[model samples]
Target: MSEATHTTEILIVGAGPSGLALAVDLARRGARTLVVDRAAALFPGSRGKGMQPRTLEVLDDLGVLDAVRAAGGPAPVGMVWSEGSRQGELRMFDVSEPTEAEPYQGLWLIPQWRTQQILLARLRELGGDVTFDRELTGLAQDADGVTASFATGPEVRARYAVAADGGRSTVRRLLGIGMTGETVDPSPTLVADVRVPALDRDNWHLFPPAGETGFMAICPLPGTEDFQLTANFPDPDTVVDLSPDGIRKAVTARSHLAPEDVTEVRWASDFRPRAALADRFREGRVFLAGDAAHVHSPAGGQGLNTSVQDAYNLGWKLGAVLRGDADEALLDTYEEERRPVAAAMLGLSTRVHRGEERRGRATQQLGLGYRDSALCVDTRDSIPPDALHAGDRAPDGHRGGVRLFDTFRGPHWTLLTVGTAPATDLPPLKNVRPAHIPPYEAYGTGVFLVRPDGYVGWAGETPTGLTDYAAAAGLA
Candidate 1:
């Protein structure tokens, strides 16, 4: 290690989607953040390929949704094949049309690498860049800050730290945190990115289990000529091969294509599906995010989406606390809110892996919220069960010539008036944007205090307790 020392407001211990996403959010908020990765470069594999609608909204707020859309298209329909013959078409997700509230519907297909590249670009645009090949070796946290030592670079000290490292998180281990989980599948699976020019790029080709081999799927990766290949091994003890020749041989044996048809193997790996969650998310000044906090089976395409959301949930709170816009107690909500959601998503992933649930609205994650959280304050009578409430996601709409999402964008809380004006003088708060819209059935009628992350933190028929809520939230 070098004798020099580096300091920042926040230290992030991974450059994957979660870390990069959090860095982007923090950068846009003018927070000094440092993101470091053990690997020499961004991830190269095509793992975690599907981006849900909620994530699209997140990217939109991060100012990278257009790039993400240009990099990928919707997931193609599955086409089963046997003996070089085509079978009927099968839909992967329960499709839905875009609505005023939910503009992004269905799953978008893009490789994990492309998504990370988009995030990194946005981070750079915000004057933040990730440091590569800086492997964390030690961590110690005091009441005031955290110190992280690297193997070959200068040690980093920051007021706060986050572990965006993957499932085998060194930071989590350093903190003595234990994860409780189970293997979702006993069989090992192989996934790879390869180029097969002979295979049509329109449909996701699938093959049923034959003589000895399990199922195989080859899906085209949008915006790229490569295809992602997935194969299953029924025997848990089978040692799968990951080399180019091995991938070509597996492709030839499973599908009608010959070994020569698989011209290139970009990347490959194998894993047994598993679901795990950390015993806790925070320990003193450090917090766990992404796969460091939870691991999913990837069946419902929930792992990456959930991980990104973990960053989204923590980013604003960290920024608010660091900027002195909120009380230090505001940070407690990170774990209070995200743990239950992670636990529920883990169960959903396991069920989807076992064919018990379909990739539908539940997988979209728009309904996930903090309704039962301590931060939620809904002081209204005769509230309908179906009406949007405090802690629910603030819906998007165009009313009174104003678009709700556009007003909610950025790292600021929004005081939104829907079909009602404040009956009393509104309390002044720092970094809080105000907007008023005509009556919209999605939100009914109320004065909602939207959090920086786009959830309604407080709602009421009028601005009765708004001042107290603002002070408690540390925005006074």
Candidate 2:
């Protein structure tokens, strides 16, 4: 490796959803960022294909939602088959409609490859790009910054570094962070992307376990002439064949379709479902996000969504501290607020994988929040339990002439006054957007200080403690 050194404000150690999302966020804020991926190119498989409602909102704020929506469609209804005969349709999830508070009420289906492409495009539009083929070999951090050495390139020194490098992360290993949890399912499962011109795209074809074989499903991928096939094996130690013929045989044996119907196998992999969380999210100047911090079963489609939200939670804080606008302590909240959320989502995914839970509102992630975090400051004493409070997701709606989401779309904190205005003097702060609207039931009567990640960081009947809260939150 070359002995030369390169520097950036932030070094992101993956180009997946989490790293790419963080790159986009930091780029938009004019923070110098470098995203490095060990892979030669973006991941090509259709893994993590489901986009939860909350992720759609995050993509929107990243300025790639239009492209994402145009490139994807809603998940199809499940069509079961048995003994070479078609069965009735099965609803995979409880259907929901868009509400004022939750504009994206249902799941969206876009292949993971396509989502990465969209994010890469948006990053380029913002004057940022990822460096491929750069594998992190070692990492060292001090009180001032982090230095990451690569296998084939010059070492990178950054003010901070984040590991979004998947479940078996090199960064996490280098930091000696241990993951704790259990194997959700011991049965090895095969997931592949294939082309089947004979398959209908309207429904996700499902085949129940027959005799000694396990279950299988073939779902058509939207905006492409491909389908994603998944099959389970009864034995945990069984070796999965990833060849085209193997995939064809797996489909032929499990489903009503013939091996010849599977015209092409684009990509394939196999894994046993597991749930694990890192012992800690941060080691000095290095932080872990996405799969590096937590692994899920992928049953409830929470892995990628939770991972992306981790980036959303950390991006603004990194930007704030790097830009000298906030105290470095703000960075500590990234793990504080996200670790519990990851743990809960892990349980949810495991339950869904075991058929003990349904893909409903919980899977949507719209109700997830950080109400109990150290950053949440709820000054009002008589607020109801169900009412919106500090650390709750700020609802999106149109009250008066301002659309709440539209106002919260950028990289800035928003002071939303609902049914009431400030009763005391406000502090001067940069990149903090303030808006006042007439009384709205969703927010009740108060001044809500919304974080850049669209969560209410502080709430009060008036602005008596708003300035102090802002200072403590690294906003003032």
Candidate 3:
């Protein structure tokens, strides 16, 4: 047969959360992207179900927050049970109220499949879709671009390619990238979505380990009658059975529910907890993203959140470089900024898995930023140490009848002059949206330049160096 050929600006492997989120971001920026997956359909399991606050904000910018929120709900209180009696109530996440600066609070619970569906919908709305059953078998890159050959489809050529195909990433292995880390848990765990009509939807039912058995929990998934069941195996060599009868037996053996109560097994899978990070995020024009870049233990629910953050961080830089709006040097900051964050998150997830850390503010991921990156520039010398700095996430608030997030919603840079004014002859910056807000303490009365990804890129008491930074960074 003749070889079919296709070309695009960017080729994204694996239509998981990271790939889909990246495709959506680039789509809104008018970038050409092709997303491919080996699987014939979207992931069916509710594997990663927690959405951190920072991820919610990222989803808000992508125009899918409403749909996601509607499909999810706040994490329910954990109800502990002993035999057939109630033990106590456990708080799964540290709850906090929303503030003017941070509009999203607490942890939102949505099945991974639902989140992917929402992002896929948004991507299609932006005039892009994923190509399924395209298993990437070979990859080659040169000075110009990267070429990929699939098992059953056409040869694809793109200026850049990303690997978001989970921990067992084909592109990563093809690039010879090493994943260095250790097993967080030696014992295997089983995660499945099941339908149980006898279970109540008010609380997340939990059962403690008893004798040879292990701990088990069942959480009601919002917007559906299905419940996510997670069970641990204390023995390292224990084999998990994924069959419907096997799942029902496990549930009956652990909880007070009977085998007949488990009406249907929707989806099921098993794995041993591990935390690993890629040796590097990029090799030439081929980039590693999401679980392909970093794998985290599911204890603190950092895996999916960090993966989405990777996509959010890289999407804008790729779009800028592909559109000739920024220099290629900007791409280097992706690994520089995200690797350390990933390492930190991996450690946090391990600690949570080991019962050494609490899933509180750290797991929320709102405090993560690129403060030490080369792209950050802060000219103010006397500002308070606790105040927002140049590389921090821009706060959300309304001043002078202008909401900051509303101004920063699209795929464009934002220039906020907070209780400050530029000089009369200030140079004009291209593709930068301008907004004036009265002195908001969150920003500390300065001129802040926000990147397309919503992080403060440059801040100064005045716009003295704004134009120069913009021109040098290729944002002009």
lDDT by residue (1-476, candidate 3, tens digit) is 13567999999999999999999999998999999999999999899999999999999999999999999999899999988888989987887889999999888999999999999999999999999999999999889999999999689999999999999999999999999999999999999999999988999999999989899999999988899999998999988999999999899889889999999999999999999999999999999999999987899999999999999999999998988978899999999999999999999999999999888999999899988999999998877778999889999998899988899998889988898773345666777878888888888787899998899999998888888889977876
Q: What's model 2's TM-score?
A: 0.98
> What TM-score against the true fold does each predicted structure earn?
0.98, 0.98, 0.98
Assess the local accuracy of residue 469 in candidate 1 as a C-alpha lDDT between 0 and 100: 92
Residue 116 in candidate 3, Cα distance off native in Å: 1.0
Model 3 pairs whose backbones collide: none
* Candidate 3 lowest-lDDT run of ten: 421-430
Candidate 2 error regions (>4 Å): 1-3, 422-424
User: What does candidate 1's lDDT look like per residue over 371-394, in tens digits?
Assistant: 899999999988988899999998
What's the TM for model 1? 0.98
Candidate 3 displacement at residue 389 in angstroms: 0.5
